[model samples]
Target: MPETIFRNWTSDLSRDWGKKPIQIDHSLSQNELFSKDALAELIERYPIEHYSLMRTSSRGEEKKIWRRGEVGGLSGHEVMAQIASGGLWLQLRELKLVDKRYHDLLQSIYGEVEQRVPGFDSFNHEMGVLISSPNAKAHYHADLPGQALWQIMGRKRVYIYPAEEPYLPQEELEKIALTGLESALRYDPEFDRHALVLDLEPGQMLTWELNAPHRVENHDELSVSMTTEHWTEEIRREQMLTVANGILRKHFGVSPKRRSTEGAGFWAKAVLQAGWRRSPWYKREQRKMMPVDFRLAPGTSTTIVDIPAYVV
Candidate 1:
């Protein structure tokens, strides 16, 4: 069978802008485009391949992973012990293994999103689409690249804090060039951080700066959503450093002295510094980096200028 490469709705937008999060609700204004019936049928037709699931648990004050990999596989049964011990179970890298049929569905809806939003683009498949099982708990984490999350079914509340806060302090953007992002968020979970908790229904979307400190609390019922990565130079650097850190951690007893892009990159870290507290760089960067500026108005188009040559 031949595969279809659908038209790229975001090619123009990708070329002109850098990544930033913007919300667009009416991209699929028609009710039929994202109905509960359509979502349920899709899930039933394409059962998830669970080989990539990873479970993390708390052992006293610290967290640990009890089991990982396939459901019936050796690691899968071992996870039961961790669950009994009250460990958290979750999945990662979902888009990599989803069935091709869903790819068609994504492409179908993606076109409408691009047209209606004016300047949005589809994410790379490696970033994957994520849907939470009922009562799922996603520990606080961030991504290497900016993320766009479109809610297809069910409900979930998301809480986010400003990436840069005075108390949090931006020490050195260069630190990201050095430890990776995941480690940075842990420095201040209790800092005087500003928070926004979102209650999302079907068809709502939230796009935000990558590495922005955030977490998810899903409803007791099913929650289905899709996510994609918008590539950039920073993302490329983040991926390389994350891999480098993993290798060094395995081969040597020492942790890599580089930033991991998993959540909140070095820029967010540096913004924590006292000098940056006085500088205008953070706000200026925010305005310049956001790719699309959209409104609820119908029949509008957006265009960004001077996107770096490297991004796709």
Candidate 2:
């Protein structure tokens, strides 16, 4: 259907699967979903809970997001025209849940990993599509699950940093996993020196260890990328521990010293998080949509209409 999702795998993949950064070749960029017109229509029809649109500044060293929007019946060309001018990013997340092609791709990936890598059996998988204006940036961030970013269209530069200490502090990771904030971290210029930077192109795929810190900058063209996340039992245990430790940090004000995934200590912490997550006190993390403040006029990028109320 797509040549093969994972083009190459090595014995090293078994040992370094979730402990280091790796880039491989894939053919997903040629899929119909990545077509500019097709993508625009999909974003317009996407559910409010699964998609996001943000207005970003074109000029600023800081990635300042000026406003966010809720999608309605915006056409494919209209959305592309807005991005073509270089000021927006649209993230359609949990795409596998909404699209069968994405679902098949993920299943195929897992099958390949299972057949090649040792001790690898993923239980859960989720994927998303990231469409951003030329020159847009993802900002430095880390995800909770084992993650792989499959490049679909356009070119971009990526920087991946270590998952420990200064790059990804424990406190910051806890905050992201528990709160409603964007998957972003406070970035310092010094950290760039240690980053494993890569120039990503269409048909290429890159993945790093679980919770690795990374960021991206798009080239001068409309960009389309697929982000896939999966969790094996071992990875699930790590998540359970991360949440448990977060409870210890935020509730008891204790900075944990050890990162153990199993034992009596681990089980106790797991139960604490499971019970706490089920309790009424734990609020689910959900982002309230920013009002639909602007609309793009047909065939033009700079012309935006200020709406009086939320778009439907």
Candidate 3:
């Protein structure tokens, strides 16, 4: 491992950390922990509940398809081979909780960020690994927490848009917060004209403003990347406000006009959201895991066999 995860950190990077879209050089590509062999081993032992194997439509396809599958009896290398054949992606979610080495690495990453950025304290950190096939696309979406993308191998083009208005409407954000569904945000091709598009390569990482809408397309090779999520005090307050506003708009037929984070109104909304969390509706509104509908074929690298769907 290198002495520092970030390779080309500067004063400007620290100054613009999360206020805008920015990309910086990193050293994780050189770490053995991210090597193909190591990642394959991790996948072989990964818990089924902590991973998502998805097949989606290829690039330029008008209809979108997102289906869940399982790795079945294939080895990690075979899974990668199948993914490289195209139209598939795997997300090893919550690596920090699944592996101690990754957990330590996640801690080191945020610790470095806190050291470089003044008064920037973040908690509830999570880290996940993404392995995707060539030409695969991650649909336009917005996340509720602070997010960053780190590329360990291959290349990808990322398009990031402003976090307000038509790109990310208040209602859509509230819906996501209320249901824990990140990919439910509406998208328009025209919005790409106003986006900041950047090609992320090996040893690069990107971070944007909180809740900024973004999408990605992988280049003509298998790609390996890491995604880290965290929450700051301000972000938590914003989420609380979103949930409270969603509840008011959805159930009480009232439109919330206040967006302030520090006032009597904000406190009242915070209490409202807190109370709602303890209610039964909150449990009912949470997103459920998709069922495993298909599995990798036993001998063929890219073949999938449809099976009776069942939730893990």
Candidate 4:
């Protein structure tokens, strides 16, 4: 990694680490991972359980899951080719946990981050690479941690909304974090009036207020980007709080009045989480899978096949 990366970092580094959305232009190398061929190989060789390829409309409203095997005999390159020539966003998720290069990259990025912002060290960091077809949209969503999107190739527009209710109610946040589902929230186009939209190009990246509701839309060309998620000590404690509060709301049918992670209420909720999550019922609930109904057809941009079209 050359120091040429992150050339756009601001002098006001202390104020911009995660409290607001900031676009650092010229912040990444497009080839930090490897060449296009290498990316195809990585996409192919990546574990089936770890990757997610999905087909969707331009606004990302209608969605159907796509699997590598659906793309002829060669799942890796075929999936890559499909994404390059067709319409999809293939998320090779949790790369830091699966591949060493990615793990090192996360550590390296944070090393830089720690230097820029004093007293800012993140834990349980998760990283992912996203490849998307032209005009693909990532519907409005939020995550449970401090988040950032680094663009490596092509262009996209990101809409960051206010981190408030109606946009993101507290109960929904607790439910999303507790259920282990992708944090997709209800999207109302009306909210666009209140959004701060940014156009991202290669060599630029965006980080926003933690847990802020946002979404993405790619331009007419294919796009590749890296996404980082991490929890601070305070953020992790908030996770525990979300979980504990969720249990209080769902199981006990009691509405929690306290949202802070510091009181006797927090202690009670934490204990409840410790006991409730230990049950087999909770384990079973976590294992439930959403249906994968379709996959992108081989060698095409818009074609898709029914789930019965493939054997595995």
In terms of TM-score, the best-performing candidate is 3
**lDDT (10s digit) by residue, model 1, range 154-264:** 678876656554422233222342334443444455642456678876667776765565677667665656665564566555545544444345334455464655555
In candidate 3, what are the lDDT values of residues 231-281, reduced to their tens digit? Answer: 999999999999999999998999888899998999999999999999999
lDDT per model vs. reference: 0.45, 0.79, 0.93, 0.76
Better of 1 and 2 by TM-score: 2
Query: Which residue pairs collide, candidate 4?
Result: 26-203, 44-76, 86-301
User: What lDDT is obtained when candidate 2 is compared to the true structure?
Assistant: 0.79
Candidate 2 weakest ten by summed lDDT: 280-289
lDDT score, candidate 3, position 267: 95
- Backbone clashes in model 4: 3
Q: Each prediction's TM-score against the native?
A: 0.48, 0.90, 0.96, 0.86
Q: Which residues of candidate 3, in runs, are more than 4 Å off?
A: 59-64
lDDT of 4 by residue, 1-312 (tens): 476446656767568778878887644555547456667778767775677667655544466643442333455666665676656678888898778987987898887788888889788888888988888888788888999899887899999998888898878887787776655478899999999999998878888887899999888888888898888987877778888888778777988767788878778877877887797647765735434557556554456677653332
TM-score of 2: 0.90
Model 1 CA lDDT for position 61: 30
At residue 288, candidate 2 shows an lDDT of 47
